[model samples]
Target: MTTGRLLIVMNAGAGHSQAEASRAAIRAVLDAHGRAYQFFLADSGSALPQQAALAVQQALAEGGAVIAAGGDGTLNTVAQAVLPHSLPFGVLPLGTFNYFARAHGMPEDIKAATEALLSARIQPVQVGLLNERIFLVNASLGLYPTLLEDREAYKAQYGRSRLVALWAGLVTLWRARGRLRIVLEHDGQRSKLRTSMLFVGNNALQLAQLGLPSAQQVEQGALAALALRRTGLFTVLLLLLRGAIGQLHTADKVLHFTFQRISVRPRLPYGRRRIKVATDGEVGWMSSPLVFAVAPQPLLLLCPATMETPA
Candidate 1:
């Protein structure tokens, strides 16, 4: 394939120094290859430039690709704008955790990643949408979303330290184990459950070490739902331990199901209070009564030929 026009969208404020370094590396690669490209920067990664979508559209009009150079959230924003136009997308994996990029087998080495992008095979992947908002990885609620919000606060204070975010999550998990009443409908079954956390995955997660059944089984054509009913602190801790040790299993307290769509209404009135949510590590506060569905084959992702490989 020929090297085409590329537009690089970067989140300059995401990881501060780290983002800057990644930007420099990207520029170096572009210079080395003498490739034609355009650079656009967003201060906080929250505000999308009015011209961003147009720029990508213009690139695609001329048969080009747009590269997202931050974390998954950045990719989600860019994807929302570009995918509908059938524009090919690339990722630079410059966030604290590059889950989407890593999962897709993009290289972590900046130069090599750039080279891979220049020669990588492209595949169409399914993306999930929550009330029209696109999520590249998963749309989750309950404790995970709460923890995501908490993690954001720690990231603001401690920068991109994963340890800091993990510590903050642990603290929040211990103090506020708020139970959410959820009504889940899957496979023609409607059930009500009180749970501390509910995870609805766009794709199954690999849990090789955890002798438990693989969550990856849910990735086929439907959405995978995992709900935890246990509210006791000790029980929660034990579950966490099991997850850490890859020994967690689907049990009565933990309900796992797969479906084409789901609607979540919290029993507690959300009012003006927003529920926390994260899409590909881009954290935000959203209103309750969330609806999520699979947007099957919505994104054209650049992945390595060996799909199972991780960057």
Candidate 2:
């Protein structure tokens, strides 16, 4: 490990007040531990992935550790830069959900999370690939992607909150229509299906919470895919209710599969070259016939040594 300062790449606009407090808390913890660090804040005008990639390069060149300090979206952006070099990845867990960090046994509190970083152990963690990009949690297409879009718009207009996000989802489901007709090719066989939502989870604990099959260790080096067969608003509502109650995997309309890699494409040929996709709470565009795969190697994550598997 480098004796230099830790390099922290943070998204300036996310959770402004919380981020400020967390930054102070981080300073306090690192100072008490006698560690040094530097900050790289991503501004509104900066292209995030590009800036983060540059920061990663600079950090690696200086023989320092790089930490991502924001939500899953920010973490995913940073991961894109770190994965290529196989650098040690650290997390500050300043995001809304903090799924990736929390799933890896990172505490949500700013001070504790920073302590975890100071006493970190390098552990191998699996990451999922959506098209050419990396996703730490899960990715989805069709209605779920559209729902994420709506949620973001709603948050931007009405201010973000858990209840507001839930309202946005309800409004989206009320107006939702159309099922994506596509073929899923896995293991030498292809299945034709029409569904409103699809979710690919990298964390097995998250899958198990949704009533799906999952191993005790999410680092098992595989991905889990969930498909919903119905597009009706009421059915979607019912499924959401079941998910809220932890019965989604047992629902008759849902299908689950585990795989090393899978391919998805529209059944009908189209002139368009790309489709809107969502991964780890961020939305973007990708070319058709999107291929999702698990990287053969694991990311070196800075996790606490005493922290066990996800509960």
The best candidate in terms of lDDT: 2
lDDT of 1 by residue, 1-311 (tens): 33678788887876678777877888788889888888777777666544357568767678878888876778788888887776778888776666678767887777778877877666777777776688876777778877887788887888767788778878887888578887765556677888888876664443333333534554455666667885687787777777777766744467666666887766666445567776666567677667778775567777766664211
Q: How do the residues 1-311 of candidate 2 rate in per-residue lDDT, one tens digit apiece?
A: 33556888887766567668878888888888899888777774146777677778877788777888887888888888898887888988876668889888999888888887887877878889987888899998888788888998898888767788899999999988867788899999999988877788897656766767653435567788888896588888898888887788778888878888999996544678787789889888888898989976677788887865421
User: How far does residue 244 in candidate 1 sit from its true spot (Å)?
Assistant: 1.4
lDDT of 1 at 169: 76
Per-model TM-score, in order, reads 0.88, 0.93
Index of the highest-TM-score prediction: 2
Which parts of model 2 are misplaced by more than 4 Å? 1-4, 215-219, 308-311
